[model samples]
Target: MIRGLQLSLNKTQKLRLESALEQLESLSSKTNTNASVAVADTIPVNYEDGVLKGHGTSEMEGQVVATVCGVVERVNKLVYVRALRARYKPEVGDIIVGRVIEVAPKRWRLEINFSQDAVLMLSSMNLPDGIQRRRTATDELNMRTIFEENDVVCAEVRGFQHDGSLHLQARSQKYGKLDRGQLLRISPYLVKRRKQHFHHLDQYGVDLILGCNGFIWVGEHVEAKDDMVVDQTNKSEQQNANSGGSVGSDDQEQSHTSLEIRQNICRIANAVRVLSALGFMVTVEVITEIVDLSSSLNLDIHEMLGAEFYVVVAEREAERRRSSTKKR
Candidate 1:
């Protein structure tokens, strides 16, 4: 019911959008009968069964009430409301994308769209040396070398401390500073937890990270380089020739990304933006479908955000949900 997008719809476009939304609402009504409630609204529950309240629900004046605007859910005796547009609630082992806000004494504080800033300690992450050695004063001093302020990073939740602050860790090669990418934010509820969040589109040559916290990253895929292999190669070269020295040459130019790859990244990113604007569930399958639809219609990347395309997407999503309901 939350429509955040503002489009200048004409008479025909407005009518089409209304019809599509009505169809979508009717389809959802048939599948789910869960009552939606606003803040401070009393939820009807049989107290004789001894209900256990969960998140977003609080007892007020001996009556069960909701503290957020969302749908009511009951799992046996436990009841809770799934908030639609709330801050990210991190769980252990969940992948997240955050920006480095500050470099502290022994930790890096990140603004991860949570209630509080999450902490990433120096000891919890892998160093550039890729060694498991203890973090000394030198390593602490060189914290900025790993992740500087304003750097976008990918990490995993490492549970919470006793002080109720979120902690993060990046121990694997797959987790580290992310560069050459665009980060897009959406409602955290739109992203559902899944087994795989890191997606590499082979055809487009792009990498997409669908963070559970609703921080989506779309960028060029960079291969993970192993520090240990580089170290071993350096040692082998030194043993072969004691006169081996590093060459310093500034003639090499940086390779620019191809135009096709850049276009693909923008197209995919715009697809995600359009989907989020429509308040639809953001899934890889749905996103891919939208991208394919745009391509099949010969719509430019910029045109995908136009009013006409928005109406078409809404109607397509309505049809998709209707078919899904029928299958159910």
Candidate 2:
């Protein structure tokens, strides 16, 4: 929260941003009634009631105490701490995006903004050929052919490994290499786990993946086909390339994303980035509204990140939340 702007700001704009921030804080405090606690803080609880301690809590010297810095939560006899500003808590079935950091013996290690690198076992995912069979040494050797270092990938939390480390799986065709787009990182708390995190803005021909790990993907929309069949033409092209022939210029051009789709990707990404910076919840509706705002005003793609646009967003968000409150 800033009274001034990262870019140049006028007095009026500064005051307006400040006012909007104050309003947002007020709304937040009103709805969030849970008491916040710090690490090792003594959590007041009725000892006679046989309190059932949960995560982020510990019993010491006959008193319920917090083990982590977070808000105190209670569910009947169960009490736990909901840590804030913490690492992404991986849960089974969570959709996440990550970058491949290492190609290991039988798996890929991915940096998913978690406590530890997540393991995507080679056996866990469906191969591009859509074959269902036992994995072999040849498949292990060709792991990089499917995914290499630094390739942005979409995956789901499979479960914790026996060693307590996070594990991932990409059995579905939707979970795989992400290209022709940008990746945005924001606070995980801003993005609540939801059923539909994969969004295709058909009007703009862009895909938006709100990864539960706080990694966002905004790129050109690719149709989700049931099978990831390798085209025979592509295979022939690969063979030609292996035989010392360069790829055709037309094929190179086809690989590049169109300027319009690229612009939309940048615009949508900027909208999410701005909302995250403003400490607002990043939801599909709010993001779409912001993108529509920029389009309606005919603002340049880069202008969406300017100080004036930030002021406008702050004001608009304040009003929208205000109206929703009134309706409720």
lDDT of each: 0.87, 0.88
Model 2 scores what on Cα lDDT?
0.88
Clashing pairs in 2: none
Instruction: Tell me each candidate's TM-score.
Output: 0.90, 0.88
What TM-score should be assigned to candidate 2?
A: 0.88
Candidate 1, 1-328: lDDT as tens digits: 3377778999999999999999998888877885899999999999999999999999999999999999999999999998988999999999999999999999999989999999999999986656578999998997886789999999999999999999999998788888766899988899999999989888888899999899999888876654555675564554334222211121122236778888888988999999999888998889889999999999999999999999999999999988887787
Q: Which ten residues in a row have the lowest lDDT in candidate 1?
A: 245-254
lDDT of 2 at 84: 68
Global lDDT of model 1 = 0.87
Please give the range of 10 consecutive residues that has the lowest summed lDDT in model 2: 238-247
After superposition on all CA atoms, what RMSD does each candidate show versus the true structure?
A: 3.8, 4.0
Question: CA lDDT of 36 in candidate 1?
Answer: 92
Tens-digit per-residue lDDT, 15-94, candidate 2: 98889988977887887885788989999998777799999999999888998888998999999998867789999999
